[model samples]
Target chain A: MLPIATIVFREFLEIALIISLVMAATQGLQGRIKIIMLGLGIGFLGAAIIAFFTDTLAASVEGTGQDIFNAGVLFVAVGFLSWTVIWMKHHAKHLSQRIHKVGSEIVAGETSIWVLVTIVALASLREGAEIVLFTYGMMASGQVTWSDVFTGASLGAVGGTVVGVLLYLGLLRAARRHLFAVTSWLLVLLTAGMAAHGASYLIAAGVLPDLVPQMWNTSHLISGESLMGEILGVLIGYTPHPSGMEVLFYVTVVVLIALLMYRPWHSKAVVAQK
Target chain B: MRFSFPMLSLSLLLGMMTLAPMAGAEEPTYTLEIKDHTFSPETLTVPADTPWTLIIKNHDKTPEEFESTELSREKIIPGGGQVRIKMGALKTGTYPFMGEFNPDKAKGQVIVK
Candidate 1:
C-alpha cells in the first residue's frame, strides 16, 4: 500500500503542480478556479473513456496510435498554453496597474477563460487516466486488496494536492503586483518545453525525425525519468538529453513567441496608445 | 511566427528523407505473451547497446497498455492482438514494462546486458 501510495503520489504531484501553477498564473481572472475544477471533472471523464478505448486506438496507424494520440494531446495543450501566454502579454501592465483595486477589476483583451479550461483538462486527462488504470490493475491482480488500493490512492492524492497548494502559496507570497508577470513568463517557457516534449513522442513513434538523436547525454547527472527530473520537466521542460529536433522545436517556440509578444512595431504602437 | 517555423522545420525534415527512412531499419526481435493478466518469462535478457523490436501478444478479452517509463516506450495490445514495439539502442540496464491495465501481475523486465 505504501509503495503504491508513493508511485501514485508522484503521478498526482505532477498534475497538481501543473494545475496550481497555471491557476496561479491566471490569478486575476474571475471564477477561473471554478472553471479549472470543471475542467478536471471533464478531464477525468475523458481519461476513463480514452483508457477504455486504448485497444482500438492503439491498433490504428500501424500500432502507433498511443504515441500519436499522446502527442496530439500534448500539442493541443501547447497551443492552449501558448495562447494564454500571448493573451497575458497584451494585458500584463493592465493587470499589474489594477492589482491594487480589490473590487474594481480590468482584464485586458477579455480573452475566453476556456484556454485555461483546455489546459487543465489535458493535464488531468492523461494523469488521471493513468492513475485509474494503474490502480485498477493492482486491484485486479489481487496482489493487493481493494481496501489497500483505496487507502494508498487516497493518501497519495492528498499528499500531492498539499504540495501543489504549498507551491501556490509560495508564488502568491511573491509581491502580488508582479506575480502575474513573473508566472506568465514561466508559462511561456513551460509551454515551449511542452511542445518539445510532444514532438519527442512523435519522434519516438517514427512520425517525426529525431535529428541528432542525442544532443548531449546528461542522464548520468540527472536522469529525466528520475523523480526530480520529472518535476523539472513539468516546471521547465528539463530533459537531460533532448534530441536535436526537440532543441530546435524548443528554440523555435521561444523565439517565435518572444517575437510575437514584443514585435517592436506592435509594442511601440501599443505603448503609444497607452 | 509559430506557424512559419513549424512549417520550416517540416520542410527541413522532409528534405532529409534519406536519414529519416533509416530509422525503420531491421532489428532483432523478441516475443512476449500475456495471459490471465500475467506476463510469461517474467524476465527477458537482450544484448545491450542495440536497438530491438518487441512483439507482444495479448490473449485476454480486454485490451492492455504495454508501458515502460524506463524505456519510454508504450503501445496498446488489444485482447487477442499482437503489436510490435521498437526501442532505441540503450546502455546496459534493467528496464521493466507492464500491462498498464494489469500492472501488478502483468509486470516484466527487459534485462539488457
Candidate 2:
C-alpha cells in the first residue's frame, strides 16, 4: 500500500501542479470551476480508454507508438498553454477590472474558456493514464487487494492535491497587480517544459536526433526521483541530464511565446519611435 | 525592431528541419527479459561512449514500467510485450534501472565500460 501510494502520489503531483497553476491564472473567471471539472471528467474517461488499449498502443509503430502518442499529447498541451498565456496577456487587465465591477462574475470569452478546458484535460489525461495503468496492473497480478488500492489511491490523491492547493494559495497571496504577470510567466515556463518533454519522446521514438545526448549530468546532485526534482520538473522543466535537443526545444518555445505575448511591433514605445 | 511573422515562421521551419535525424552508425543492441518481476542477466555491459538499443521483453502477466532516473528514460512494457529503448552514450559508469511497479524485486543495471 505504501509503495502504491508513493507511485500514485508522484503521478498525481504533476497533474495537481498543472491544474493549480491554471486555476490560479484564471481566478475569478465565471464558471471556471465547472469548465475545469468537465475537463477532469473527459480526462478520466480518456485515461480508462488509453489504459484498456495500452497493449495495442505499445505494439504499434514497431513499438514506438507509445512514445509518439505521448509526444503528441505533450505537444498539444504546449500549444494550448502557449495560446492561453498570450491570450491572457492581452485581456488580463480588462478581465480583472470587469471582475471587480461585476463582483466576481466575469465571463472571459467562450474561446478562452474552451482553451483552458483543453489544457486541463490534456494535463490530467497524461498523468491519469499512467495511474490507471499502474493500478490495473497491480490488480490483475493479485499482488494487492482492492481495499489497499483504494486507500493508497485516495491518500495519494489527497496528498498531491494538498501541495497544489498550497501553491494556489501562495499565488493568491501575491500582489493583485502582479499576479497575472507571475502566473503568465509561470505558464510560459510550463509550456516550454512540455515542449522539451515532447521532444524527448520524439527522440526516444527515433524520429528526432538527440543532438548531443548527454550535454551534462547532474543526477548525483539531484536525482530525478526526488521530491524536489519532481516539483521543479513540473514548474520549470528541470532535468538533471538534458539532451541538446531538449534544451533547443525549451528555448525555442520560451522565445516564441515571449515574442507572441509581447508583440514588440504593437508596443507603445516602438509605435512612438516609428 | 520589426519582426515579420513570415520571417519568424520561416526561421522556425528551418530550425526544425535542421533537427531531422541523421543516419548514424547502428547502435549496439542488448536484450533483457523479465519474468515474475525479475530481470534476466541482472546486469548488462556495453562499450562506453557509444549509444545503444535496449530491447526489453516482459514475459510476466502484468505490465511494468521500465524506469531509470540515471538514464532519464521511462517507458511501460505491457504484459508479454517488448519495447526498444534508445539509450544515450555513457561515460563508463553503472546506470541502474528497475520495473517501477515492482522496484524492490525487479532491478538491473547497465555497465558502460
Candidate 3:
C-alpha cells in the first residue's frame, strides 16, 4: 500500500504542479477556472483511452512508439505554453490597467483560453495515464486489495493537491504586483523544460542523438528519485545528469523565447531611427 | 509579431531535421525480461564507455515502466510487450533500475566495467 501511494504521489505531484502553475498564471482571466476544469475533464478521458491502448501504442513505430508518443505530447505542450507566454507579453499592460475589461476580452477572444485548455490538457494527459495504468495494474495483479488501492490513491491525490494549492497561494502572495512578469518567466522556463524533456524522449527513441551522454553527474548531491529532485525537475528542468541533447534543447528554447519576448532587434531599429 | 509564430515553428522543424537520426545498428544489444514483476538476470554486465541498446520484454499481465535515473531513460512496456531503449556510453559504475509500478519487487542493476 505504501509503495502504491508513493508511485501515485510522484505522478500526481507532477500533474498538480503543472495545473497549479497554469491556474496561478491566469488568475485574473475570467472563466479561466472553467476552462481549466474542462481541460482536466478532457485529459482524464484521454488518459483512460490511452491507458487502454497501451499495448498497441507500445508496439507501434517498431517498438519505439511509446517514446515517440511521449515526445509528441511534450512537444505539443511546449508549443502551447510558448504561445501563451509570448501572447501574455503583448497583452499584460492592458491586463494590469483594466483587469476586468482585459479579462473578459481574453476569454471572448478565445485564442488564449484555448491555449490554456490545451496546455492544461496535455499536462494532465501523460501523468494521468501513468497513474491510471499503475493503479489498474495493481488491481489486476490481485496482490493488493481494492481497499488498499483506494486508500493509497486518495492519500496520494490529497497530498499532491495540497502542495499544488500551497504553490498557487504562494505565487499569488509573492508576486501580486509583478504577477504577470513572474508567471511569464516561470512559463518560459517550464516550456524550455518540456522541450528538453521531449528531446530526451526522442534520444531514447533513437530519433536523435545524445551528442554527449553525461554532461555532469550531481546524483550524489540530489538523486533524481528524491522529492527535491522531482520538484526542481518539473519547475526548472533540473536534471542531475542531463544528456548533451537535453542541454541543447533546454538552452535553445530559453534563448528563443527570450529573443521573442524582448525583441532586441526592435530596440536596435528604433535607436537607428533616432 | 505575427511572423514570430511561423519563425518559431520553422526553427523547430529545422532543428529537428538537422539533428537527424544517427543511431547505429552496430551498437551492442542487451535483453532484459520482466516476469512476476521481477527482472530476470537482475544484474547485467556490459562494456564501459560503449553505447548500447536495451530491449526490455515484459511478460506480465500488466504494464510496467522501466526506469533508470542513472541512465536517464524511462519507458513503459505494456503487458506482453517490449521496448527498445538506447543507452548512452557510461563510465565504470553500477546503475540501478526498477519497475516503477512494483519498485520493491522489481529491481535490477547494470554494471559497467
Best by TM-score: 3
Where does candidate 3 chain A have its weakest 10-residue lDDT segment? A100-109
User: Candidate 1 lDDT, tens digit per residue, A12-73?
Assistant: 88788888888788777667767778888889899899877766776765555666677677
Among these predictions, the greatest lDDT belongs to: 3
Q: lDDT per residue, candidate 3, B1-113, as tens digits? A: 33354356446645653453445489999999999999998999999999898999999999999998888889999989998888888899999999999888999999999
Q: Which residue pairs does candidate 3 place in steric collision?
A: none
Supply fnat for every model shown: 0.18, 0.38, 0.59
For candidate 1, give the lDDT of residue B94.
85
* Tens-digit per-residue lDDT, A194-263, candidate 2: 8998888777766677889788888778778889998989998989999999999999999998998898
lDDT, residue A146, candidate 1: 80
Q: Itemize residue pairs with steric clashes in candidate 2.
A: none
Chain A TM-score, candidate 2? 0.95
What TM-score, computed on C-alpha atoms, does each candidate reach? 0.81, 0.91, 0.92
In candidate 1, stretches whose alpha carbon ends up further than 4 angstroms from where it belongs are A96-111, A144-146, A174-178, B1-29, B34-52, B59-70, B74-83, B89-113
RMSD of 3: 3.1
